[model samples]
Target: MSDNSQSAAALVQRYYDAFNAGDVPGMLACLSEDVAHDVNQGGRRTGKALFGEFCAHMERCYREQLTDIVVMPSADGRRAAAEFTVNGTYLSDDDGLPPATGQTYCLPAGTFFDIADGKITRVTTHYNLQDWIAQVTGTGA
Candidate 1:
């Protein structure tokens, strides 16, 4: 692995560390000003301001804990993939649309990050929505 690859992996690690520490500001620091984040289970959040909103919403809805984080080089050194499990506790009533049962849930997710100029420029995240619904509602197929 080259130095760039190692650095990229390190950056991904930092992201997970920030998340586990609940340091939203620190996580944002690892991103570029024009960062594009697609929180698959959530929605697309672009730019720093919108990203901050998304983070705030997440903090309001769930207490997040990153259980396992594994970072690896992707197609090139500039890109990396991180697989992680995020366990969350429902904090308040779900008021967005269909009300939630207000139950705790564990979500296993993966993220692919593209780094540029030592910052994360883009991130594509994946997770099972049905599993999340099941964990929250205690009902599913």
Candidate 2:
């Protein structure tokens, strides 16, 4: 990997590290001031302020820790992606979602990124919402 790729990987690693630590400020520091986020199965959210709100909402509704994180940065270092397993519990109800009963779940998730000037400018995330719902509701095979 080129030095740039290595640095990008390190940045992403730091972000996840902060996330695991529940260091919201530290995670926000890794994003651009005008960062764009594609919330999984939800609408797009932009700007760090909004991102912080989203993070807060997540912290209120779910307890998650990511494992098996693998980040792959493009050769040019302008883009990257990560895949991991989200081990979590439904701590509270999120709007339009099943009521939380502290349900435990493990889901594979992925996120794509646009990096510039050593900051994440855009993040697009994906996961199986139906699977999560099924696990939370005891309605799936």
Candidate 3:
């Protein structure tokens, strides 16, 4: 891989490391000031402040640690993607979702990223919401 690609991978790795550590500030430090976040199965939210809010909301509702992370960066270093397994417990009720009762789940997820000046400018996360719902509701096959 090129040096740029290596750096991009490192940046993504750092972001996940912070996430696994439950270090919100550390994760935010890897983002651009005007970063855009495309919520999984939801609309896009722009700016680091909004991202911080999202993180806070997640913190309140769930406890997650991402494992088996694989980061792939484009040769140009302007984009990247990561795949991981989210091992989590639903801690509190989130809006429009099933009531939380400390249900545990393991879900495979991925995130696409756009990087500039060594900071993430955009983040788009993806996962099967229905599958997650089924798992949490004890309806999964």
Return the top candidate by lDDT.
3
* Sort order, lDDT high to low: 3, 2, 1
What are the lDDT figures for the candidates, one per model?
A: 0.83, 0.95, 0.96
Model 2, residue 125: C-alpha shift (Å): 0.9
Model 2 residue 79 lDDT score: 92
- Tell me the TM-score of each prediction against the true structure: 0.89, 0.98, 0.98
Worst 10 residues of 3 by lDDT: 132-141
In candidate 3, stretches whose alpha carbon ends up further than 4 angstroms from where it belongs are: none
Error of 1 at 23 (Å): 0.7
Q: Is candidate 1 or candidate 2 better by TM-score?
A: 2
lDDT at 12, model 1: 86
> Which runs of model 2 end up more than 4 angstroms from their true locations?
none
Q: Residues 95-115, candidate 1: write the lDDT tens digits.
A: 553454467778789998889
Considering lDDT, which of the candidate structures 2 and 3 is the better prediction for this target? 3
Q: What is the descending TM-score order?
A: 3, 2, 1
